[model samples]
Every structure is written in C-alpha cells, then in structure tokens.
Target chain A: MNQIAQEVQHQTHTRLSEVSTEDLIVDIHGLKKYYGDVKAVDGIDLQIPRGTIFGFLGPNGAGKTTTISALITLAKPTAGSGTVVGFDLHDRNNIKKHIGAVFQEQTLDEELTGLQNLKFHAEMYFLPKPVAEQRIEDLTKMVGIHDRLSDKVMNYSGGMRRRLEIARGLMTDPEILFLDEPTIGLDPQSRANILQKIKEMNEEKGLTIFITTHDMEEAESLCDQVCIIDQGKIIVQGTVDELKNSLGNDFVIINFNSPDEMNLAMNLLNDLPEVNEVKSSGSVLHIGTKSGSTAVVKILNTLKEKVEVNSVEIKKPTLNDVFLYYTGKELRDDVADLSDRLKMVGRKKGRRGMMRRR
Target chain B: MYASTSKSQDSYNGFGIFTFIRSIWTVYKRQNARLINSKSQLISIMIMPLLWLVIIGQSFNNLLGSSNPLFSGNVNYITYMTPGIFVMITMFSSLFGIISLFYDRDSGYLKNYLLAPISNTAIIFGYAMGIYTRVFIQVLLILVIAIAIGANIPITVGSLTAIILFPVVVSFFLSGLAITLASRASNVETFQAIIMPISMPLMFLSPILYPIKALPDYLQWIAQINPLSMGVEGLRFVLLGKIYTDGAIIDIAQFNDHLAIFNFALLFLVGIVFLIMGSKTFLNSLYK
Candidate 1:
C-alpha cells in the first residue's frame, strides 16, 4: 500500500472499532428480484461501509445490474428488504436524493451542451439554483471538463463524455454514487485516468462508491472491498488481500517430463507435510502451500528423489486466481451465456423483444 | 461514520402538486430546446402547410371553379381549406412529438426522465405541453401563409383566441393517441409503420382537403365523427362565424352553439380519456 492508502487503512481500522449499523452506507439482507420463475437477482446480502470503494464484480447477467436496479428503485423486489443512506428501500425518492447513479449506457442528451445536462440533473434533484451552479462549476473542474462545458455532448469524445457523466452524478453532492461499469469501453489510458479520479473522490470527499465491473484488474487496483457474484449469488467477498490470502498464501507449479511423472509428483506432494493441495493439468502440477519460499525447498527435497521434475516456479495468488478457485470457471468464458439468460428475463417481463437491462 | 465529511442531508419534504408541475415545466423546457435546435425539422414541417395553401388550394380552385355555391358569398376554396389545414398541422405536430420519444428511448435518454423523482403523469403532461406549443406555432405560421395567399380570414378577439387555444386542445387528444402507440412499440421503425397507416386514413377521412358534404354518405358520416373534423369545424366557426356544409351557409350563432362549445367539449373529453389511457400504458411500459 502507498503511504496515503496506508493512512486511509489506518483510519478505516479506527472507524471499524466504533462502527455501528449507521456506518454502513448500503445495508441489505436477503434481497431478491424475480421475473416470473427466473430469479434475475436471487437472495443476496451486502453491508458496505461508508467512505470505501466497493466493487461488485460479476460477469454479465450475473445479477449485478439487476441488484442495482432493485436498490435504485428501477425494479421491484420480489422479497427481502434493505436500506440506503439511512432510508428504507421503498423510500425511493429520499434514497434517490442521497444517491446518484451512472448507468452502463450513455444517457446524456446529445443535443444539449454539457453544462445543460448537469443543470438538468440538478433540476431533477431540486437543487437550489445558486448551489447547483457552484457545484456544477466545481465538479466540471474536478473532472477536467470545465473548459468543454459549452459544447454539445455529441461533439465530446468518449472519455470526455464519461467524465462529464461522473461530474453530473456528483452534482447533487450525493453521499453514495453507483457506477455500472464506469470505464467499460474506454482506452487503457482513459480507463486508468478515470480509476484515479474515482479513487481520489473516495479519498478526498469520503464518498462511498459502489461500482460493478467485469474488469478484474480495475477491481484489484481500485476497490477497497470486492465481492464476486455468479449465477445470482455472491461466491465470495472481502478485502483484496483477504480474498487472495483465503486461496492459500502461495502457489508452486512443477513441470514434469511426462504424465506419469506428473501424477507421481502430485501423489508425492499430497503426502508432504508443508503442501496443502495438488492440482494437475497436462504435464504440470500446481501445489498450494504457505511460506512458499521455505516450503519450496522442502517440496523439492521430497520430489527430487521420487520424480523427475523439469522445472518449478513459485506464483502468488491474484484476484483472477481467487475467482477461478472459488467459481471454478474463467470470468470471460461465461459472456456468451449472459445474453441467452438476459433475453429470457426480458421475455418473461413482457418486454417487446428489446434487450432492456432493467 | 463518514457523516462528518458528508454534505448536510437537508430534510426532504415529500413531493407535492407544485413539485409535480415544476418537473413537467422542466421537461417542457427541455423538449422546447431540442425542437429549437433542430431548425431543419421545424422548417420542413412548416413547408407542408405552405404547399397545401399555395399548390393544392389554387389547383382545386381551378378544378372546382373560382366561385362555388358551397362556400359563403365570394369566398374561394383556399379560404375554406385554411381551417382544415390548421387541423392537419395540429394532427401532424402531435403525432410527430412521440417520434422524439422513440429517439429518447433508443438513445437511453428516456431513463433520465423515468428515473427522475417526478411521476409519470408529469412527464406525459410535459410532452403534451411541448407538442401543444409546436402545434400552436405551426398553426400561426400557416395562418400567416394563408393570409399572404389571399385567403380571407376574419381576425376578431374571439377568433384569435380560438385559433391559439383550439389547436392546443386538438393536439392534446392526438398527442395522447400517439403516446398510446409509442408505449407498445419496441422501436422507431415499428412505431412509424403503425402510425403511418392510421394517420393517413384519419387525415383523408376528415375534411382537410375538401368539404365533408362532398363525400359519399357513409364517408361523410365517418368524416363527421373524426376528431380532426370536429377541430376544423370549430375553427371554421370562430374564423368565419359560419360554415359551408350541405350546400348551405349556416351561421354558428343562429345554428346553435354546436360549432363552438359542443365540439370543444367533445374534443376535451376525448383528450382526457386518451390522456388517461396513454399515461397508464406508458407508465406500465416504464415500470416492471
């Protein structure tokens, strides 16, 4: 962690000691939303602390968007309950006043100038004219779009439009901001720039941000906490370090010359005192263990006698590796299935063959 | 808690009727801005009425003779067709307003209004008001064009009021019909496909291009019941104080108030019914 991140962590620890239910900006339990027999968002729970960036990581149609719609009052829940920003879930207007959302799609009016879009949002929220004007100016400058405020949105580049959307979301000085794939299609540089701005917003303003993204790297680099959801259920959630640590502290892979040798080495490693589990693919064997530097020597000593190992390398667990360990599938592989299920949900909701996310 | 750094959460008084009106007004302003920005579309719509008054009016005047017994003394065909043209403008304006709804839907901008704190009724009312303003503007332009083309339209205070307010009511009813169709359509193509056939028949079946008495008996009955026909007759009464129907010139005051109050009441009632139906369907399409 960097110095400021460590300082933020220190503050987080101190606040956790005195944290009450009110400290959770978003608190929900057993939330469910069903379309006919399809449980688009099945039973799920979340308790996100204030001033932390939380990532809801999931593949498309894994209920990330559905859950957001339910919380933001775009969809009605079939069961369970929740509270957001000290208001009940059904208190939609009050909750909307305290929370802002940037949808996955670009929802800005292309014909309107960037400034007009921000002012219109303020009008919808009933912000006083003078207060709205000041915030609009401040937020545009913060997102670095103040100079282009007079240009129509259609004339904006994709990154500039995304920044303006973020600025608009902050126009009401909302307590919590919800971003659905905030940087999904931006270039690498733009993506990094937006992520930096998101982190800065969370740190400087103590804004509780709830983000959902399919990008694991974004979650790993930017989120203070993340939850992996699949098939409408949360598989795992924790701090980045904790989730990685949960999948064993180290991974040691051994490459053998033959399948016979790989099986023999896997069997030998199973009996070793330091190794936890051995998984084999092709001619290579992956061994999970703790204190990998020290354990590597002992594992090699045990294997050197019975097996002919071609090469051995030690690896650290990443968020992707943890996702694989928990979900038993690659994140990108399920995208094809996402569309079929989304269509089914749309049809069940009586939509006229349009793929409306909510 | 992070409340220390958080902005103060002002106590929210729940939305009242005034809040509802405010939201509608804001949406109205937004629609007006969009309409103003698209100058080409505005000019294109204005040209349609000009064509009707100049080309269609003169051609029919030659075909049907310059002096016809069906019209009041010395009144030409163009003067009689002007009110019908205004009704046509109102119909087109109201229906075209919902085309923007489809664009809003495709562009995802509709979600901004849908997710806003305002009720669906407010949004519908706002769109209706916007369409009304467009229809009013187009009618005024057509009136200027007609007068410039030598159509004799009387300009009394009552007639001026009717010209301004009558089209607003007619557009309200048509706007509701348009919204009802838009709520069920999945895309712009389907909406245009469905609206074209319905709109063409309504226009031809009404008395926009010719007198209703000239149609066959069954067609005349159909034209008489058309909402556009009611609007045209009311406008004709206010603008001319009489109408040429059934080969006779009947004064509205002597012929009972059916030309003014009766038709206005009918149009108002129809507008309310369609507004209710349209808003309900549109709201249903929005929510799960």
Candidate 2:
C-alpha cells in the first residue's frame, strides 16, 4: 500500500512539473474548423510556450485567421478540442479574460477618442476604474501614444491608430496578446516602431505574444518560435535554427557555364555522403551540406570528375531560405489543386445549408 | 507572466450579477456620450417628433373640424392625435437604432463586447436600454409640448405613472423587433432593406393618425392587434379625458379600466417576450 501511494505521488509530481516546465500558453490538438466542405483549418496541433513571442507565418488562405477565430471562440471547431491560457476554448468567457487580440480588421470606435476607446474596453472586460486608468496610462506610454489619447481615432494616423489598438488590447492585462498582421500596411519606420513596442511588451510584462505575419523578416526578427502554414495545413514549425537546420546548416551555390554541366555536377555532388539536398535553377546549382568547409573540397572534386566549376559562393541560412526550401513549386501546385476541389465541394454543401435554412 | 498589472483585476474577476449590470450601464453611458457629442444630430432627431406633431396633427385637425366628433373630451382632435404622435416618434427612433447595430457589427465594435468576459445578456440589454433611453428623451419632449399646448391632459399619480411607462413599452418592443431583424443582417444596406418595408405596416395599420372606431371594422381588428396601437390607446387612457371618436364614447379611461388594462398587459408581455427572444438569438449568432 505504501509503495502504491509513493508511485501515485511520484506520478502526480511528474505531471505537475511537466506542465510547469513546458508552460504552454496554448495547446491545440487536431483542431479542425470547416466552412461547409472547405477545411479552413485541417487537423492543426500547436503548443505555444508561455512568455514567448510566437509567429504564425502563412500565405493568404493558409488558415491562420481561421485557427485564430477558433482559439478566440469566434468560430467553433468542426472537430477536436483545445485550451488557451489554461482554460478550455469552450470556457470562452474565462478564456477571454486571459487573452487579448488585435485583429486584421480594425475594430476601434472611430467616433470616440483613443482614451474613450480604451475606457470602453476596460468596462467591457469589467476592469475597475483605478486599475483601468493606471493600466491605460502604462500601455499608452508603452506604445508611445500618450499625447494622442484624447484625440479621436478618425483623426489619428494609421500608425497611431494601430498603437492605440495595441494599448486597448492590453487594458485588461491579458496573459497573452494575439496580433493578426500588426504591421501589415505600415511604413518601414512605423513597422519598426510597432515591432519595438512588441519586444518591449514581451520584456516588460513578460507577455506571451502570438502574432501572424506574411513578412519573413518580421518573423525572423521577432519570433522565438514559428509555424509556417499553407492551404489549411502547417508545413513546418520550430525555432529559426531548427527550421534552417532542417535543410542543412550551410549551403553552397555553384554556378556552371552550361546547363548540362550543372546537371552532371549536381548528380556527382549527391553521391557525396556529406551533401544533404541539391537543386538546380538554369546554370546555377544549389547544394545543402552539414559541413560547408569540408563539403566544398569534396563537391569540387566530385564536379571535377564531370565538368569544371565556374564559380562557387557560400551562403548562411535564413528564414527566406527555410521558406523556399520547405515550400517549393510542387507543394504550391498541390495546394492549389486541393483548394479548387474543396471549394467546389464546399459550394454544393453550402447550397444545401441555404436550402435547409430557407 | 508576472502579476504586473493584476492587482486591479482582483476586484472585478468574480463576474457577479452587479458587475454585469455595471457593464450594461457603462455601455449605455458610452452610447449616451456618443449621442450627446453629436449636437446637430440630436437637434435634428428632436425636431422630427415635434414637426410630425405640429404639421400632421394640425392638418388632420383641420380636416376633422370641431364638430367632426373624433374625441368625446372638450380637448381638440389634435389632442387625441398627440398620444399617437408620441408613439410614432418613439417607434421611428427605435427602428432606426438597429441600423447602428448593423454598423457596429460590420465596423468591428460589436466584437469588443463579443470577446469580453461579460455575458451576452449584458450586450443585448446594454444596446436595448441605450436606444430606449434615446427614444425616452424624444418621447418626453413631445409629451411636454403636448401638455404645454393646453392639451393639459388630466392626470392623477397612477395615470401619470402609466403615461410615463406607455412610450417606454412601445420603444422596448420596437427595439426588440430591431434586434431580432438585425441578428441576420450582414450590412447596413441589408438591414435597412429588411426594416424599411416592415415599418410602413406598423405605422399605418395602427391607430396613429386615426382612431380605431374611425376606421372600418376589418382595419379596426388590425388596430386592436397592433402593438403600437395598444401603446397609443394606453397613453390616451392615462393622459386624456374621455376617449372618443365620431361622438362614440369609448370605455378606454382609467375609470372604466378592464380593456385598457388588458391591452396594456398584452403590450408589456409582447415587449418582454420579444426582448428575451432577441437576446437569445443575438447571443447564439453573434460570432457565427
């Protein structure tokens, strides 16, 4: 009996430690949201760690917004379950208390002043007067819009409006902030300002951020973790290094004088044990390798057997390269074909729904 | 995350009924602020009710001269028409308020409430109460002007209480009707198209410009069933002298009270039922 009791205690302790150690702010499993027969979000599973800046990088129609809508309880999942900020998604009211969001579509009351907009949100969230005022001050200052708080949002610049929206989202002191395209239409300077504020928020409040962006540079600089989604599916997800390392750590681009030489050289390089992947565009051949310094000599020797190497250039890994590596032309074609078929099916299903309702 | 700004949240985290009520009140107050800030629009809205009163009431009175016997009281036909005008103003305002609901939905303002910890009941109630409050102000102005015009309609405390509540009942039901219609509309144009055609029947088929007895028997049935007509007749019973049309003494006063009470009860119940239905439909479909 004592041994059994000890085992149960040990198990309970292990479970608690695991939860705290990983500290997921969001945990989704097989979360599927379908609009008729079009699977907008298809069996997506993600675990976002606490107090980290997470990025969702996707092309248009990639289910980023659909996944967000499900998480925020704006749309119900067709299948599966999830928890956000430790509360079940179905426990929407409780879950809402712990999360704040800035959507792609602007929701500010344009007729009202910035301060009034924030005040309105504070009341909606039931924040007490004193707390609301103080936090309002802090957030406005943090976003660098303290002076324009009294001005109507209609008169404010787009950057100022975006900043005010950020301030308003933080009024309730949410544990996590979701920003859907926070800097989509901003100038470079405005984009930098917003990014800087996001970093400061992560540092000062230790606030976990879940941001979605199409900009690779934004994701590369801001996110501690990223998941790239395409056509209702996650293609790849990991830290920058992990994703870059997925296609070898170092890449060498070998330009040949002839297309035939490039093909022959690519085949010979693939025979080398150190080379990971190879691709050719016109007369240029790109090679992925675990060890560029050691592989370069072997690659040159391999090419020397078939043809002469015209020029060679060594390149570092970047998110752009990671994206290109993961989502090639074939994958895009597959997504387009699947999307067309699904949309046709969706229209038929949707017509039935309209008929039933009518 | 550390509890950087969480100390303030402690007071409001319980989600109590009082807090919900406060949420309703605060939302209404902000709506009030928006209305108050628009001075030109407020004046324009306030002028419409009185304009209908002066123009439509006087022309109808001229058409039905003193001996036309549309009212039993010493008061003129315009006085008999006053109660209907008050309800008419409130009705128009109530219907127009739904356009703003559609605006809020498309504009993303409704999402602030949808994503909040507060109950959906709070949002529906907040919007309902806010629009009613606006209607109340316009209805009150018309009432004061009617009384000032020597249509010094007789009133005791009980009758005065009913008079105050009569327009409220109409506005509440109208606002509920708006909410129900607006729940399915995707844009202002769609909502306006839906609401416009419905407004004509509610306005004309009722006893607004004419009395129930003045119309034919079949139309009188419609007037009797009309919610706005119920409100107009209820208001007349409370604020005017003997109710009459065409020298026929109608038993609609507080002195002879059963039918009036029944109509009042029916209007009140319809108002409440629509409100409840509207609230349920709104919560279910808000984010869908």
TM-scores for the candidates:
0.88, 0.85
lDDT of 2 by residue, A244-319 (tens): 6665568788989999988887777777898888988999988888878788888887767579888998887888
Cα deviation at A250, candidate 1, in Å, is 1.5
lDDT (10s digit) by residue, model 2, range B1-288: 327557656655656888888878877877877787666658877887778777887777778746675453565776777778878887888887756666677667787878887777667777777787777777778777777765546658876677668777787788788878776776565777888887898888887777667777777777667778778876776566453432354423233467667877877788777777887786677665
Task: Report lDDT per candidate.
Answer: 0.79, 0.76
Top candidate on lDDT is 1
lDDT per residue, candidate 1, B52-161, as tens digits?
A: 77788778877764556665454567787888888888898788666777767766787777776777777788888988888887788888998898788888788889
Residue pair clashes in candidate 1: none
By TM-score, the best candidate is: 1
- In Å, residue A166's CA in model 2 sits off its true spot by 1.1
**Which runs in model 1 stand beyond 4 Å of their true positions?**
A1-18, A255-271, A297-312, A333-358, B1-12, B65-67, B242-255
Which digits, one per residue and each the tens of the lDDT, describe model 1 over residues A225-326?
888888888777778887776665698988899999888877777888888888889999888889778889998888877888899899988888877777
Instruction: List the candidate 2 regions with Cα displacement exceeding 4 Å.
Output: A1-22, A253-279, A287-314, A329-358, B1-8, B13-16, B71-73, B147-150, B154-160, B243-255
